[model samples]
Target: MSQTPLLPSRREFIKQGAAAAATFMIVPRFVLGGKGYTAPSDQLVIAGVGVGGKGESDLASFAKTGKVRIGYLCDVDDRRAAKSRQAFPQAKYYKDWRQLLDKESKNFDAVSVATPDHNHAAVTLAAMQLGKHVYVQKPLTHDLYEARALTEAAKRYPVVTQMGNQGASGDGVRQLQEWYDANLIGKVHTVYCWTDRPVWPQGIPWPTGATSVPPELDWDLWLGTAPFRPYVDKLVPFNWRGWWEYGTGALGDMGCHLLEAPFRVLGLQYASTVQASVGSVYVDEFKRGYFPESCPPSSHVTLTFPATKKNKQEVTVHWMDGGIQPERPEELGPNELFGDGGNGILFVGKKGKMMASTYAANPRLLPLSHNQEVKVKPTLARVPGGAEGHYAQWVEACIAGHGNHTVSAPFETAGPLTEALLMANLAIRGYDLRRPKTTGPGFDYPGRGIELVWDPQQLRVTNFEEVNRFVKRDYRPGWQ
Candidate 1:
């Protein structure tokens, strides 16, 4: 039997590869094609700031494009980052995003920010300021002002940007758009969006006592722009969604997926007026309260959007969460699922009605059978793999450079959508505003009865001054 040849050692393989490459080195496109030259054929190098949970999955999706590389990984918790470190073994690791950016900015072409809502703006803005493309997670930022600032930055800096709402690139939304455009669902006046969320705890007082911080986690760094609080057990990895400082609750979590369809189909922009009502929780045995530190267990918010170029006539959008769903439609069989059971979106129009499930998936005309009867020409181009293609879409767009190709959910579009959601939150929070009573020892909930009129251009609530504080929250020390 012939003996098998031995493989080269790591050092020998590197040296041999280097020698072989030196003989016929290929120049990079930027070097050969000159400044501002990027094409679909080129590769995209990305630095992931929050590489765990959704962050880790986001990076994995990007790398799956086969035209991208994960060059750096950063996360506050070492334990949370263990899987990504093992997957992207060649990537440089860091506990601080600022340090990663400062040291390796020159080596990467784009940045993917899947951090909590509070950290999205600072990391994304810094990357854009460096002229790097960015893909940020949903809700975009912790507050409205940050969303607007990043929206403006996309214009100021020549960089391609996309929000992490993959549903925007789905074929379902396009079909909805086509149906609407074909007048199948004529002049939609109202939309109802509902979700079963807060899979984490909410409506409870902040946990008491300080738990010892995990050795693998950097508590302070995790806080980012949010105010510091003592570390508590089970707050990391998940459960932060119920806290006001770190998350935007169910609306922030599911709004993007459910709202994108209506926005695209009707061309909705900012809301003109917003009103809300919420379910309350009792801190003790006696009285009900707003536990402003935590998101209410459930809420129903109403928003009126003014006429835009694409959608004439005002539209009313209802946002429901915490298992509150709209009254069942009288269209068909009782056994048929309503909006994929737990989550759904229903659009009401003058001529007919249509609906879709979360991520704008499973679209159907009311009566169910109308779906097969209706016919509308598909006018929009589709992303190759639909929702699954979202990551690769951004990669190819970054390679195509700013303005050369359009992404599904660019910052320009995501900003206004995010602002509208945050606007609704103002009402939920305002429901708890207190004032010292004129005579007695107790406080009055003045914000309960009023409708907060919005001034989108000025970016403030014209009627309620108290809730404006949430629009542009102060950054923690040194974060600025």
Candidate 2:
């Protein structure tokens, strides 16, 4: 199941598109006039899928490398893609990624996917199968099975791949790792990662008003892989993050950024056991609302990870969202800011505590002044420009070819990281699974009040079979 092959294999596609690729070629940088300029063939040609929102900035960052060419732009909504299309006027445009890959797969050397979490694996897997390097946005995929599949596919395909968790390249995480290594913070047993997210609405009933689909947006194409649903107002652009159909909720939206620090600091992997509790919403005084279609308003999840080489004892990581945060350490001054004031990660070690803001930025020891008392020397080499260099890092790696270069969050790393987070997501969704009671007027919450035991190799919850359906969702017909 981890090695599900896409429709067209690399060898077959290469032979099929050989003729179309041979006739046309872009003018080389040198041909356009400049001494000591690299040839166009040396540049990495990338196809931009989902060229809107973050996709626009991702393309801009990739182009900044001076070693990449945005050769193609693909998006379902032309209005959302207008900025990117105008920025890269010379790039070919397409409404469907399949058509772009079918006709121009041979032309581009790589593909950058910044689509919603649901479409990440679809575009990424196809690109990898075609022998193209890929850079996908964070959280890697929408489900655990997809993350696992992409991981195995990365090994099978000889191409460079990266996840857009730029913080993995930041110096702060490396600093935290060094502190742990030097024993300045003793042995970390617990970590608290919190965020004030879900800025969009959640825990609300789905909108039911009948509305017309916008002319510029291909509603059917946008709903690729996900079940067919009527277009809800404001669901596009951003609000989709709160809905399970299209996004991974708050954890998916910010987990990659917050969790990267601890994963790097302790060399964490799969979680052994997981449990979660979510906040409730009420439609009126009489009853609490039950809107399973949307993610809960907020959640606090606890995951237990077995001991690793970096840490001797097993670790417990807590994920808090929707303005929830752990108690402030008494070592710090009361008025001092806590975790960039809104979003932050706290590592509690036997001897001391260390924390950082989102993206693992601004690392400092507890008590603020204790940072001055610490004397851990820098050991890990830093990425150029830190977090900002993530884009160019992947570009240079693609230029250097698969194993020849290093990417901060390659599938090898991002895959497992994403899987663990998605595993936690199961607990969140499971907490809401409902069934009719044998002889009652209400539903039985069987998935609640339980700790989900995970079998990573099998990719399922050992104790709860019902939640496994979410591990690997079925793609809509014609999509798979």
State which candidate has the highest lDDT: 2
TM-score of each: 0.91, 0.94
| lDDT by candidate, in order shown | 0.86, 0.90
lDDT score for residue 79 of model 2: 95
Worst 10 residues of 1 by lDDT: 1-10
For 1-480, candidate 2 gives per-residue lDDT tens digits of 334552346787576445535533445557566788787776899999999999999999999888889999999999999999999999999999999999998789999999988999999988887778999998899989889888988887778999999999999999999888999889999999999998999999999899999999999999989999988888897888888888999999899999999998999988999999999899999889999889888999999999999898999999999899999999878789899988999999999999999999999998788888768779999999899999889998987767999889999989989987898889999999999999969789998979999998888899988888889888999888
Q: Compared with the true structure, what per-residue lDDT tens digits does model 1 show for residues 73-180?
A: 999999989999999999999999999888887678899999888899989887876668999999888888887787777766678899999999999999888888
Model 2 C-alpha RMSD vs. true structure (Å) is 3.1
Q: Which residue pairs in candidate 1 have backbone atoms (N, alpha carbon, C) closer than 3 angstroms, thus clashing?
A: none
Count: clashes, candidate 2? 0
Output the lDDT of residue 30, model 2.
Answer: 71
